[model samples]
Target: MSLSLLTPLGHSNVAELIARRTLTAVFQPIVNFDGGTILGYEGLIRGPAGSALEAPGALFAQAAREGLSVALEHAAARTCVAAFASLGCEGKLFLNFSAEALVALGETRDRTVAWLNEHGLGVDRVVLELTEQCQIADVARFVTAVGALRESGIQFALDDYGTANASMNLWVRLQPDVVKIDRFFIDDIANDPLKFEAVRAMQHFAGASGARLVAEGIENAADLIVVRDMGIALGQGFFIGRPDARASREFAQGAREALDAGHIAVFPGATRTPVAASPSGGMAAAKMIVAAPAVPKSATNNDVLELFNRLPNLHAVAVVEHERPLALINRRSFMDRYALPYHRELFGKRPCMLFANASPVIIEKSMTVEQMAKLLASDDQRYLADGFVITDEERYVGLGTGESLVRAVTEVRIEAARYANPLTFLPGNIPISSHIARLVEHRAEFYACYVDLNHFKPFNDRYGYWQGDEVLKFAAAVLADVCDPTRDFLGHVGGDDFLVLFQSDDWLERAMRALRAVDTGALRFYADEDRAAGGIHGEDRRGNPAFFSFVTMAIGCVRVSPDTRGGLPYGSEEIASVAALAKHRAKQEASGFFVIDLDEGAAQLHLHEAPGAAMPQRASALS
Candidate 1:
């Protein structure tokens, strides 16, 4: 077992060494971050017994220097396949390859697949990981080779994506099924905003390109928390399991043992173990359960009014008969429909206004406090019930409360806030988009305004981000004040950009006035010296120096008309575009307000026309 004995003496000596079995392979498991399930293992090649080379990296490096890189790769593949056969683990096996070896051998992939098939390992179980340091010469050839292997069920993953140049472009073009982000990027993503932003951008890109992102080289629990919060679905790192042939079996066994013991095992170098709950706690131990509220389908409006009078804070009443659910009637709907004059005749009849879809959004009895919280965080207030009705196969079981759901959602919000931007305190783009879509469906005559701060970058560069941030907060407060929850909405769409939805046209004028007043008042933050010496202070993107002055915002407003008009007055996609155009026009004209005219055949027309002009005016104004 001396190191000198394993040295390759010559071609003949190496051939004899291969014949006599000189190398071995080690397997490491890659685990998912969310549930700690084993995704697969990377098969790391090692030196043979009695070899000068101590590890695979050294052995492969030496092999390449000796012009035997192709031979070494073939030997590694064979050794890895042989070792994989004995494990009987049903997961992918990742094998490494140098780009040079792939191009040089020219026909290595086909032969390797055939050899693997000859052994017990099939192409479906194999994953070829393109090594980080390899320089791909012929991308087309490499793609062709990998594509051929993939047709046989082999998968390709681009390793160390963030570490190399043009990696993103390569990934986009090759369209690999998986892209393993370099550990450097994942290590500090939780604390570093730039790193987190980069991960988010990469994740979005991967999703768009139909590729899965795998964060590799995670080393601790802290890192695991960051990746999971970032919503990464697949992960691989030393914190999960080290590279070893028995790692998967060890993980499976440990997981099963943990399940049986009703406890999870936490240790360094150990596979992930699930924390199982004891079955002894039954219905009596449940925190909250959905109970079918006693609602009569044949009850009159007076009956519902009596029920509400009895329970003034009623969230919703489920209309159910026997064990089956019929509909959900909320307090608001009852008031809106039955409180009208001449609506008394419909009182004794069944309420056709029930939301039957509410059943799908119901909470189950077995749901934990944590799970219940997430459902309520994004849920609408109108859907809240005094408690969720617990049911088993149409049989009414128990009840859950709005208070409990609120507590759960609060916890989820807190957990979500850990990763949310502190300045905006919004759920970022992913959750923000969902909120916008929900607002759109409300179908009100709401004005969605895209707010952009003019010359704010110059201010940031001249004064500092601290003051610039104050200005941003001031703008946010102004917008928030103008937005009425009962009639409007406000959202911070990242730096210096805000969105406000106004249900009332009067509020639009108020919002503009409030923003102007805030901007004017915020000017006092700067010193008297700098205030008087206002001029361009920073360079624009084109490298030209630009002047800095008082802050101003160009607001673009698009009215999302009610869908009841049969068809949209304007295309939804053109709303933001037209608003942006109007805002740009305002910016160019140095005007405080501008409106995007959505009227048909109004091209080249001014938004505000003179009295008695071609455009029609209000009949009251004419009088």
Candidate 2:
């Protein structure tokens, strides 16, 4: 309810409600990001049913206006503690209170403690949330009071951080036990770098201050991964659980799957070159929607005509029934039909569905540009002319033109190609990293093969960079041919280096096949004399003469599985590092292939415990 709707006469109602003790409390669970468990519930208040002050916002607003904020907060605290105790909730109980309410609680400490004991809520299990709504005029006095409360085992949290009056100075002075990041910074943090950085900075601050960070408003899997990866311990949001009189004891299935899926979120990166025109993040359809006026299914053709006449630039009109879209009437088609002889007089009063395509394409606002592109390929191409209706949960919101969908899809396609290697047209570094991250996220069983050229520098020196490019192309083709495109990803990690994430069960055979192909193809790139001698003489980097063998491929394979044996989960960067080590080991072998089975503890032994002796560096293929 709006404050403008409240009157001085409502003062008596507020007093009467408080005197009768009619306040109720609901709880929303706070989840632990790392463990994927409920850490606690934040207690929230609601007023009497069907009243002007039914919402906490309106209730608190009225209380503040009447100078009864402290009294109301105290009564609300009692209600929340009683409700939580009655429900037999576990873990900590967070109760929100303004600075004034906190100071007042400190004055009545003994009485409040006794009151909480009566409701079976210990001071140890209660965490008072101090919002930055009002400034603490007396810092020293407030600190002393908070210190006394802390002595009584009452923890404190700073709410709605990173906005308004929640300043650095206040943080240092109060030194809260928990800091709740405001929704402004937490929303869409996965896509927005600025918000991500802000939360990261807060995470670091919390670490140093010995305080825990709670990311507020985490409503999606992408954002959840970003926050969880950032190491924030606690999260609260509608996606996690909505406020309820009896909140869920466990997380939702979607939240549980996302947290346990082991897939690392694919972070969006800025594309620098024209090779990739845009970033890889999905753009929601809502971004391009036009808020076109829609007509109900009951509307007549003349009504739609009037709407079209009123808005000269309107493309199409959506026919909705009970907020659900039924069809789309293209403006041109409708106008053309009305232009026929005596058509206006004959059918102008008829139902608009006469000209509407009943099978109009309707997409949710959350649909991505890439998803919409797939729809454009469908046999029914009328969406191009009729324009698709945008909806939220199947309820019509607006209209989106085919032109915008094509433009967005084109940009996304360009972005996907941005990381392609110019020499071989294979995916480049970013794509390689993204694919590896995806594999790790899905917990897929795959072999990460790091393919590099052995003794490549001598070939480049003898045959020149042009021939070196040919050798790289040949290697890329061999690897590509060995991969099952439907189950594998091949990427060119610059120069002569390639990475293949093979999901095919016969990855061993494929690796060996590529190696054998490289062995046969290596001779063709060499000079007649070098091919005959099986080697070439070149000056080493130390100025010493050396006999370098003909360029051959080295495949370092590391098997990553869902059942990895380690203290920590495998990350994309860690997998890359492990693969590089395996590649170095492969260079030492004549077979040109080496495998590190993580299940056999070979990775830990080689990468961590052992740290094997130094190996010789291969010559740069680019040089």
Candidate 3:
């Protein structure tokens, strides 16, 4: 509600205005960005079309100047609720209450309840919004009053967040269900880095405190994306909706399409497919099962000899018994034995399985590329000649040539490791960026999280550079420990910043838990004095005595296309842009908290644990 200049119209006029009941309530829709659906309607009080009190600012200011603010607000609530119900609004009815009236809600709540019932509106449908514009005298009492009203099932929302009236202390005292970020920080958020950071920090604070965040006054598509990327739970402004006496019961098509962009089957005429631009780790295994030539156990030894000559490239042959691999016949071993005097005459007519090696190495078709490397490393001559048999559920599928396996492993490892950081051995910038492109191309849903330290630079300056290296190593280990091995991708985006692309659906909670643990454990790494002081003491670049807080990390998370959330992008570049914004927000907040940018993709969630958590990680492929 925008306030206007104090009216010269006096006390008598304020009283006269309330008696006339010349006010209108227009509702502004608060939308759920994830679904492009209306979460609720906030009732904004406005005066008559062209009167002196047409502006809410003028009406409230004149009333406050006359000590009749509470009386005026009570009247406004009655009028607003009645109009809201009559318009057939479908969501919660959010009514604004002045600080003056909040303290005196004894009769006001009952009167508002009566208006709601009369209009067929339930108390549960009402959300009493208190803005920070008014100086809340006695926060404890205010919190109590708001809490006391909850017994009737009415929820409370704190508005104009970040202002003095809605400070952290107030937030703790009240524990409001929702905090609407002030529009001051939302306007042109995409272009303004500072505002973007502020909004993201607020979003993280809200998530940690268990409050839903609402960004008010999103003006355009870019601003909407910025707010959505910060994972703001709800939004209000011209972009989503506008204030009108008649509130809309449903969202328009354009808004719906934008919100559902990421998961839909067809986007801009392109088919959405599972992200597979280039498979890595476990993902590569699915494509590695090449067909192999096999024959029944009854086939004569002559059949094997003839097969080798027919397909010269055949590395080895699997002797099959009832569709299961019974043994492997090495071309050289079989041919060498036959070359010895009369060997072919003695065995050429016998069953091939009888002469074949019975204990050849075998691997599952689903085994990861990394796992394959390990299995292949376990043997030499036996596997070298006979190669390895690929199976599906114990049934023979194909043969993996030793040379092919070695080449494949080397190529996969090289591709994955080339851009890895030397110190931590985590995939570096280039690979992370490429992975994002793969996500967009495949239309796979994954969480891309950017992680970094808060006070590392200062701590390093205070101590030595090597200490910083130890800290980086520790962080890398912790990340490896927490992230799912088979599904998640971890990369070192240079000093202090890392990226984790999560293939699981419940990554938000997992990310939160893991980072929280890191923050708790990181404290001991500091010097004795710094540990006691809660942070390192050092000189700033400008030579000032800077007290650096204990190391805390920030994780900025954004979900990639998998469920067609409107947060959908043309490619990795857009997601990177958003991640950069999220990273900035995380650094500013620096609480070792996870800030997830949520969209409709959250609805299609199916969290899967990553494969091979216990196995040692193969640090990036080749580099």
Q: Output the number of the lDDT-best candidate.
A: 2
Tens-place lDDT per residue, model 2, 1-623, is: 01111123344656667767788899999999777889999998899989989999999898877877767777777778888999999999998887877876776677777777877888899999988694887777788878878888889999999887887777898899999999998898777644665676788888899999888887987777767766688999988888999966987777777676544443323211222213442445888899999999999999999999999999999999999999999999999989999999999999989888998888999776656778768998887777899998899899999888887877776765657676777777666776777666657678888899987877888789998899998998899899765457777778788888887778899999999999888898777878899799997878799998888899988889878865446767667767776787898888888888754434443445444655334322111
Candidate 1 Cα RMSD (Å): 26.6
Q: For candidate 3, lDDT tens digit of each residue in 1-623?
A: 11121123344766677667678888888899875778889988888789888899998898778877777777787778778877877889888876656656633456545656778998888887777765777766766667667766787788888765677876776677888888888887665534554566677778788988888887776566546644576888887777888887765555555455442111110100111111344434446565878988889999999998998877789988777888898888787888899878888898887679888888877676656677665745577667878887789988877777777777765665445666776666666677667667756678778787878888777667898889888888888777654346777777887777777556777788768777887887776877777776778779888778777778767655555455455456556545655666566663645354544213212121135334221122112
Clashing pairs in 2: 262-441, 263-441, 264-441, 275-418, 276-418
Clashes of 3: 21
TM-scores for every candidate against the unseen true structure: 0.41, 0.53, 0.45
Regarding TM-score, does 1 or 3 come out ahead?
Answer: 3
Model 1 misplaced regions, further than 4 Å:
1-19, 48-52, 103-111, 250-623
Q: Pick the candidate with the highest TM-score.
A: 2
Query: What C-alpha lDDT do the candidate models reach, one value each?
Result: 0.59, 0.78, 0.69
**lDDT value, candidate 1, whole model:** 0.59
Candidate 3 CA-lDDT value: 0.69
Measured with C-alpha atoms, the lDDT of residue 414 in candidate 3 is 67
